[model samples]
Target: MTDSTHTIHPVWLRATHWLNALAVVTMTMSGWRIYNASPLFDFKFTKAITLGGWLGGAIQWHFAAMWLLAANGLVYLLCNVGTGRIVRKFFPLSPRAIVADLRAAFRGRLSHADLRQYNAVQRATYLFVIADAVLLVLSGLVLWKSVQFPLLRELLGGYEAARLVHFFAMATMVAFVAVHLAMAALVPRTLLAMIRGR
Candidate 1:
């Protein structure tokens, strides 16, 4: 392909990507604050203290960010599919090459194509993150309004089970974001590519 044919991610994607990041991070923070209300992971077995300020306020932020995040995700998915970006990027590939990609990535030999350095680990991590996001949202709905989503609650094994999945998903996503940030900082040029759409 010529220089003109180079695949620069569309502006819509770049905008939505950053917006989604903001929304998710906001929601995660507020969600953690509220989780202190019950403390799934950090919940003390002793006394309940409104550690972050107020439960109601944290919930307010959670719901507000949820709407924005959902909107951002919908547009990202729709446009990527409608424009063939998904097909181009997510299509099935050979196991052999995937293994080679990982070996190369760890060996510091993998020069990313089009500035997207998703070797095996990245590809798998991204795929799981998307799946986990869907699960987190669905499980959240079940917990948010169990009466309205009884079937979903049942599918999740129960209200408590759904909550457990939601909690773990949030924790996992935070870890992923931390690792992602570390990688981004380690490769400043890679970050520039994302912004410049190279």
Candidate 2:
């Protein structure tokens, strides 16, 4: 198919993508609020940008967003894998190619003409984010239901360890969001394609 006539992102892809984005953003903000109630580290996120009014409210929002994120992510994963899009679009990431792309990106020579196809670096980043999301969900499950999921909790090294893993995964996700926004700023057309599925 020609580029002009081709549809880059299908409706399901676009819908789930945005829904997942919304879920993650809300979950992250509310999670910050909840974290501030009893921090694990030295620092705490300010209340100004946090979601929900208080700790209980934040927990409610977090759980709501968690369900949304989990459901949307499951659909996205199943659809992508069933249609072979996962293999065709994201697999076979070569370390050499990723390194080359990273160099080009650093040198400000990367191209973003083909929104349908991802570069090596982009593919690697997406895969990493997906893995991180899975880790977050699993660790969260352990944190939420340690008593019911004793095996899972044990596998993740108990409640406290699971919480630590969850925190780091959240931090990684936030970093990914920052980089994703930067990339969107650099290539505005990519954002338009996502919005309109061009």
Candidate 3:
């Protein structure tokens, strides 16, 4: 067996991963505040878990975080593509593989013996998250400037529809974060590998 202490996450991966985590947390909190300002649903996130004291303040925070997320995400993607990590680590995914891995995971039979390789479930989740983030950014742009982003606005079914899309995208990201944290806890060494790059 290879030494688990060997580099698993490269420096760039570690940096971008943590930066993305920060941006996601910041955006989610501020977004909750924004949602409370004009909720589409009956429920609202309490102030204790949300950032920004008011609507305007929340908008500012959310926009700021959005830029951070966008920039960091771009860098991460470029590095992944440049290094061929995107194809090596996340490709060859199939529906059957995902289903098999997911069942194994639920049955506590899945392996984390290889930190450098992603199981099919991980590949699908990460890919979905990447797509979801892109959707969030586009929908957010539509909501922030409907007239300025007429093409995106129309594609998303207009301003009001864009708002729903953004909200749901945010919700999906939050759920992913929750599961990610839980999985990290369940496999503490994986967290260490991320932090220590091994």
Supply candidate 1's per-residue lDDT for 24: 81
Clashing pairs in 3: none
- Number of backbone-clashing residue pairs for each candidate, in the order shown: 1, 0, 0
TM-score of 3: 0.96
- Model 3, span 17-127: residue lDDT tens: 999999999999999998998889999999999998898998899999999999999999999999999999999999999999999999999999989989999999999
lDDT (C-alpha, whole model) for all candidates: 0.76, 0.93, 0.93
Q: Which stretches of candidate 1 lie over 4 Å from their true place?
A: 1-7, 42-52, 116-118
- Give per-residue CA lDDT, model 1, range 61-112, as digits (tens): 8888888888888898899789887767665556777888789877988775
- Comparison by lDDT, 1 against 2, better one: 2
Cα displacement (Å) at residue 187, model 3: 0.5
Q: For model 1, name the residue pairs that clash.
A: 39-43
Model 2 over residues 1-198: C-alpha lDDT tens digits? Answer: 436457788888999999999999999999999999999999999899899989999999999999999999999999999999999899789999999999999999988777888999999999999999999999999989999999999999999999999999999999999999999998999888888879
